[model samples]
Target: MVSIVQTGVANRASVIAAFERCGVEATRAATAGDIEAAPFLVLPGVGSFGAGMEALRAAGLVDALRVRIEAGGPTLAICLGMQLLCASSEESPGVEGLGVIDAMVEALSQPARPRFGWNRVVPEFGCEVITEGFAYYANSFGVCERPAGWACAMSALEAPFVGAMRRGAVVACQFHPELSGPWGLKLLQRWMAMGVAAC
Candidate 1:
């Protein structure tokens, strides 16, 4: 399964190795194919919300992903990529997201700006449906969702930002699942086993 996405700031080798441990043949984001044929897609990011969306638009991946996932396909978004799944992001003043999930990506409510480094995504507030642990985080914005099964994993530092969420065919994670080692792979495999229709 190829990890289809935009830009390459995310370590592909690490992602490949992670997916391989889960019994998958991972590839880059640009393998060139449709939803049914490709099956799985991973969106990873490591930069500003506005800049990342611009890069995706420039590469014409925004619509491509929307179309794919809209048709009942499987997709995983990590870090900044998860931020782009919302309707809008505070990090980017006027930038638009895929709007797959009805939420907005807002910056953390901290004294300073640009929250970085690792945080503990403890399973509090019924956010345990997803992988729960001290996952590595490196993002500014997070999702505020309004769904029944809207699950979120959070760190100890901030206000428990949306660590991971799934709605229908879309899945997004605020943490670096690829960097979380085997635990990340296991969660990813669960998403893969869910298949396209399960979403």
Candidate 2:
């Protein structure tokens, strides 16, 4: 079963529906015990960096997430959820991220700070989850400093940002898989397949 960390900021119902549409059963996990009871975890987020982290802390999920991911638990973070995995973000200075991955989230360098549309992403460094296709994106901040080969996909929009990154069992995406149509669903399916294998 997939445990979705309930940050109370993301579209939790929509994400769960997406998973169900793909024939995957997912549960919303709010407490540490709920999080620990699942085989795999999905962290979804929206809004500013500070608010997201605050919600995670308020829900007392930070340490539980850290422990799970560090223990090699399969995880997928989406949008602001992915940004929260970084060490820090320029979106809200002085706010610390979960720091599971050594990277920083910064404002997109594109003309429009918040890019809103379908953008094409190409897989880099032989990433298994990232495939070349159009994925929906609506974000003001993204991981600009990709840790070399960890970048699963690269999007040229917003001055070539890290569209997706993966290390071991932890995977993150700046795009919303729940809203990216078929490509997004396929990506989630790939994630579930990987999660099943890891189990």
The whole-model lDDT of each prediction reads 0.68, 0.84
Query: How high is the lDDT of residue 24 in model 2?
Result: 83
Q: Kindly list the per-residue Cα lDDT of model 1 for residues 1-199, writing each as its tens digit.
A: 7565655465566667788877788765652354236668888777777888787787767777777766657788888777777778877778888877678877676533656666656554544446555566666567654434555555544354566776554567888777876677677777787764474
Lowest lDDT sum, 10 consecutive residues, model 1, at 28-37
Q: What is the TM-score of each candidate against the true structure?
A: 0.81, 0.93
Worst 10 residues of 2 by lDDT: 143-152
> How does residue 129 of candidate 1 score in lDDT?
43
Decoy 1 TM-score against native: 0.81
Write model 2 residue lDDT over 62-165, tens digit each, in one string: 89888887776788999999999889998889998998878888778644377798999888765767789998998988887676536578887637888898
